[model samples]
Target: MIPLLFENLSIENQPVSMPLPNGITLTIKREDKNHRFVSGNKLRKLKYNIAQALTEGKDTILTFGGAYSNHIAATAAAGQAMGLKTIGVIRGDELATKIDVNPTLKFAKMCGMDFLFVSRSDYRYKHTPEFLEDLQKRYGSSVYIAPEGGTNTLAVKGCEEILTPNDAVFDVICTAVGTGGTISGLINASAPHQTVIGFPALKGEFLNKVINNYTNKTNWHLVHDYHFGGYAKVNEDLVTFLNVFNKNTHIPLDPIYVGKMIFAIFALANKGYFEPNTKILAIHTGGLQGIEGFNKERIKKHKSILDYEEKI
Candidate 1:
């Protein structure tokens, strides 16, 4: 059954059509198309976690996430597919009543995920032993805890499969970092000659520690200039860039992660960040599932939604 989720995995490399400076050739690994529900890094992160849960005879998987988190959606779907119950410990208690209006939560509910909503303050202690003990008491011993954003050693092991021998030709490999799991795996698998660049979706010096906890590789570095005021924060320029980028390359980028990474890559290339004839491969870690909920919020605010929302 685990193999079923990855049957459609397609990491096809597609070149971007753009007038970039320094003769840097940009190509994207379409890991987004890996699965329908458990796409991209989410799928990779969840693969071994699910298997381990089943191996340990766990009947349920418990995790944490926000309203439109890709990890939440993917975990719910994986649980449903594997016949395991899923418990989502959501960040906002208010979102408990708003699931019907929120695409990610609603979809998770449809996939048989039960939610335990908590206030943001309480969510900070989610990894604490006392909080975990409480969860065990509430959900019983049959529950397996999958960390928020699904970033654990097992998840990193799964993500290590993201790179292949064919990717060695690229001088640089790039990906968007959230909790730093995917990039950690990429760093481990990257060739010594390849510099792995990470564009964080949020601003924090803490990510270095997070990434360091997972791998000992020294070929990776994070660029802090393009988070756009932090996680899930978007402006008009980003939206316009996403639309125009999709129109030009026919590749849809989710605003939270990949969109920012792509924008940064373009801006950096234009600034001559790479030398001439350098080949760069960017990983498209899919969070496109959240675009619907995001555009819904934009519509309610009387703002422009992503123009390519319908295309991908």
Candidate 2:
């Protein structure tokens, strides 16, 4: 057995110190430090999925995502660590030639995951029977498919462990939403006295429908205003916040997910969003490996550049 996934990675709740208008207390659930490769919510999402794959006697794992997807990189690393083959159905065909240039894909390639790059139009059909069948034909029957972002019932079950009995004291539990998998788990785990909020990384109305299909919990809410622009879209204000927050908390956040969620929480807190003495717990979903690509996009804005190790 690949031994890394068998380690008992501990989770910590670190308190955040900041000036707020109300008497609001904030803490972060440090899920990112769970593992070096399969860190953050990814580990939670993949825990049982990998078990199921093994129980089914699968020797290979197949999945889909964009070039910079944390899910793709995590899947590749996990499979290699677990002694299984992995295949990634990447969204852009042009990216096939840029594996060396893209940090996330570069790591996946290093872990021995093969790539099958497809056009954006073709990627939209990934869930359809025909597209999945084509994948099976190419990768063989030993493949176990992981839905993009590792969102599924098993993932939800793993994410529910994020909220311990101690978390019940917090009035609100917050996390960044990708495919609604992480939030769905939080919603399922939240106490009746608590509210779980999903701060989406992208602007969309369909998340409710997708999340609703997972859980029947009514204590959850989606905050749509914090996406900045859309998925992977970042502005100067956001870049500044990411840097400042890391400086203040010594915690790194990926621009796509955790960065935006933290920025929103601080802004709302400053604007008197929470009631006096409200307790909030922000989930630090890890995607720190994507900072290389994010900082490359900000090269024109920032004179300094961070290499891979330095970013980590």
RMSD of each: 1.3, 2.1
Residue-level lDDT tens digits of model 2 in 1-312: 324584466789999865556788889999998888988998888888888888889999888899789999999999989898999999999998999989999999999999999999999999999998888888788999989999999899888888889888899999999999999999999999998888999988999999999899899888899898899887778877777677777778888899899889888888877888899999999998888777776686764433322358
Q: Which run of 10 residues does model 1 get worst, by summed lDDT?
A: 1-10
As for candidate 1, its clashing pairs are none
Q: Name the lDDT value of residue 210 in candidate 2.
A: 95
* Each prediction's whole-model lDDT (CA): 0.92, 0.87
Runs of candidate 1 with Cα error greater than 4 angstroms are 1-3
* lDDT of candidate 1 over 1-312, digit per residue (tens): 354665445589999997687678999999998887889999999998988887888999999999999999999998888888999999999998999989999999999999999999999999999999999999999999999999999999889999999999999999999998999999999999999999999988999999999989899899999999999999999999999988888899999999999999989888888889899999999999999988999999999888793465
Q: What's the lDDT for candidate 1? A: 0.92
lDDT of 2 at 226: 88
* Model 2 ranges off by over 4 Å: 1-7, 300-311
Alpha-carbon TM-score of each model against the true structure:
0.97, 0.95
